[model samples]
Target: MELFFTSLLNGVTYGLLLFMLSSGLTLIFSMMGVLNFAHASFYMLGAYFGYVISSYVGFYPALLLAPLAVGAIGALIERYGMRRAHASGHLAELLFTFGLAFLIEEVVHLVWGKSPVPYRVPPSLDGPLFTLFSATFPTYKAFMMAVSVGMLAALYALLTRTRVGLLVQAALSKPDMVEALGHNVPRLFMLVFGGGVGLAALAGVIGGNAFVTEPGMAAAVGSIVFVVVVVGGLGSITGAFVASLAIGILQTFAVAVDYKLPFFDRVTVSQTAPVLPYLIMVLMLIARPRGLMGTRET
Candidate 1:
């Protein structure tokens, strides 16, 4: 019972982290119809920016400034780089983002080198929040959960209750009509793209210290973000939320289990934890390509 309860908490924490990272990608895809391969790179940039900014001022300031910096960069990319690529077609845009990911990784190597930086959790949130059985949950993890939930709430309210959201949603399905109504559709795309990447950077600001701050961190989570997005359904924020928690809990419990499969005696459940999400993705594709709670077909 103790193990189950503890694992459940840890799993939810990890799942929420995944949601934070993937939500940005979901928003970008849903609003702009662009896959954004470089999305996780922005997340990596956020962590590094947070590290540098926090080193100079503090974590709280970095928490605010880092995402803003990343968001600006994203907007610029959309304006200068992606805007030009958009003229060619969706394939061009996809290729542009795919190459952009490599460029960002190389830039990281040039600036920060390959070594992991000292991006520790803030001293204020370094201790335990509460104990379950013999296990103690870290305050930082609780802070992460709070931030993730808060972000979800804020995003929900912004999209459903604001004029800006209505315009953005209008642009998504009827760009021409929105433009005919006198809104700058192109600028709207830039903002949506920027906002999406900004969300990714925000995740980095919080997650970098909780995990590690390294150039390779983007690659580590990039694939999983896609899996979550796809498993939850492409362009579905609610689906992403559900999938994030599900995958988070699934992987967390898998790590703690020791059972072996009937045929694969050599592999324990714990050993398969790394590939479980991908396996789920494959199974999901086979079973229901549209994804859980997803409105569009994959």
Candidate 2:
């Protein structure tokens, strides 16, 4: 029972992290109609940036400033890099992003080297919050949960309660109409794109230490972020949220279980951990092409 509960909690936590990354990616895709292969690369950038800032300053300030830095980078990329690629169309945009992802990874290697950097939790959040069923749950995990929930709630409120949010949504729903109505959709796109990048960076900031801060970490987990976005449904915030949580739980539980077959006694056991989420993602796509909540085409 304890083990089950432990796995459940871990899953939820992982799901929140997934949400942080995928939510931004979905928003970017929906608004710009571009698939950003570099989204996860930015995530890796966030972790490294957060580590640098936190090392010199402190975690709290790093948490606030790192996302802004990432957002600025996103805006620059959009203004120059993506804008030039935009002339050629979606294929161009995707290729641009893919190339950008590789450049970013190489840059990370050049700047930080190929070694993993350890950024431990802040002193305040270093200790265990409590012991459950003889298992210790670290306070940092709770801090991560709080940050994820807070950010999600803040994003929800912004989208539902603010005029800027309303205008952004309007533009997304009817770009032609919004442009006809005299709103600067281009500028709005920049802001929204930057905002999405910021959110991804923020997730990276908090999650760096929880996972590992390394050069290729973004590429490693990048596919999973894509899967969450697919599972949640493209361009649907609510769908993305649900999918993120679901993926987190799925991965967590997958690692916890020991796979065995009665009739397959001769089959050798794999030494590594579980990996059922990828299989589930494949089946989900095959069975539900639209995903659990996705609606956008192409």
Worst 10 residues of 1 by lDDT: 289-298
C-alpha RMSD for every candidate: 0.9, 2.1
* lDDT computed for candidate 1: 0.93
Query: In candidate 2, what are the lDDT values of residues 66-174, reduced to their tens digit?
Result: 9999999998899878878988998999999999999999999999999999877789889899888989989998888888788778878888899988888889779
Q: Which parts of model 1 have CA positions greater than 4 angstroms off? A: none
**Candidate 1 colliding pairs:** none
Q: Which digits, one per residue and each the tens of the lDDT, describe model 1 over residues 17-129?
A: 99999999999998899999999999999999999999999999999999999999999999999999999999999999999999999999999999999999999999988
Off by over 4 Å in 2: 262-274
Instruction: Give each model's clash number.
Output: 0, 1
Model 2 error, position 90 (Å): 0.8
In angstroms, how far off is 112's CA in candidate 2?
Answer: 1.4
Model 2 clash pairs are 233-294
